[model samples]
Target: MPGARSGGSGGDGSNSGSYSGDASGAVTVWEVVSLLGKLLGTVVALKVVLYLLRVCLAMAWKSGGASHSELIHNLRKNGIIKTDKVFEVMLATDRSHYAKCNPYMDSPQSIESLVFNSFS
Candidate 1:
């Protein structure tokens, strides 16, 4: 009787739908909860992807060894690099000029072909 007005009800005389403060509050609360749930889910998914990436890197590291190809494979497989230019450079340059022994080793070798020019 408080919210009811007399004449414009439905044909059966039932009151039309009405909005209440409590109903609006409930809707707002549910909206906030749903947003927070989505945000948290996204964060969890990102963390899982990163964890998987780290695991893949560790596996590749264990299987990786000395050799230009293996080194490049490890670098490419673990997402350390995204371009093919590294391969071009490695292939274009001869390691024998830089490395005295272990030319195919992954570690850096001392420069054996340095040309010192006296500019005095």
Candidate 2:
């Protein structure tokens, strides 16, 4: 009777089974929310994984860095990592290196040898 129904009257047969419209810009809104959710989750997960990897690598590379002892402490804070192997790595460093806590300590043949010899 009127030019068009207020609700677009699907049951009245005036309109098709479905409504035709982009629908008040809601499509864009929903897409933006979904994309933001996924992007945020991905970023958070990546940060956590990268942090764990960093800790693992710090466990390996500390002896070559300036703060070898501090790196051992950080690993301890993360969890129960074996300090003995890392200590051996520090021990195996060259004589001129300043990271060694003890200036008088002898440089071991290798980290492998130091670990074996210590436990033996």
Candidate 3:
């Protein structure tokens, strides 16, 4: 009652409802709904921005080459493949031979499925 503002009954035979007090004291129903909508919109906007940022970073990390030598060259240029021996080894081992999908991408690939054989 202290923070509530009650509206008189309208001519439409409907009683005007009262809203509860919020952190900013007494607030209307429309104000609460608007605030909730704004909060949800902000959250969704942030999620979309984050998703775009992740996609951009992934694209940046991608070597953009369809060959093992090019992939290794990109890795060495990016300083991931530090030494010559490591670069040679990586270049010698073709990812396409092992990875079935997106082998040239700078990410982990599931080369094969693990089969656990239990001995009774």
| C-alpha lDDT of all candidate models, in order | 0.65, 0.55, 0.76
Residue 12 miss distance in model 3 (angstroms): 66
lDDT of 2 by residue, 6-96 (tens): 6754566575536454646355677789999999999999999999987776553333323445544444454435677865674455433
Candidate 3, residues 1-106: lDDT per residue as tens digits? 7976546767696655474356467778898999999999999999999999876754536664777888889878866778999988988998887776788888
Best by lDDT: 3
Write down the worst ten-residue block by lDDT for model 3. Answer: 111-120
Pairs that clash in candidate 2:
none
Assess every candidate by TM-score. 0.33, 0.32, 0.43
Tens digits of per-residue lDDT for model 1, 8-99: 57889665668544634466777789999999999999999999988765553342347756666665676654678976676567665566
Instruction: Look at candidate 3 and tell me the lDDT of residue 98.
Output: 74
Which order, best to worst by lDDT? 3, 1, 2
Total backbone collisions, model 3? 0
**Model 1 vs truth, CA RMSD:** 11.3
Pairs with backbone N, CA or C atoms under 3 Å apart (clashes), candidate 3: none
lDDT of model 3, residue 83: 100
Better of 1 and 2 by TM-score: 1
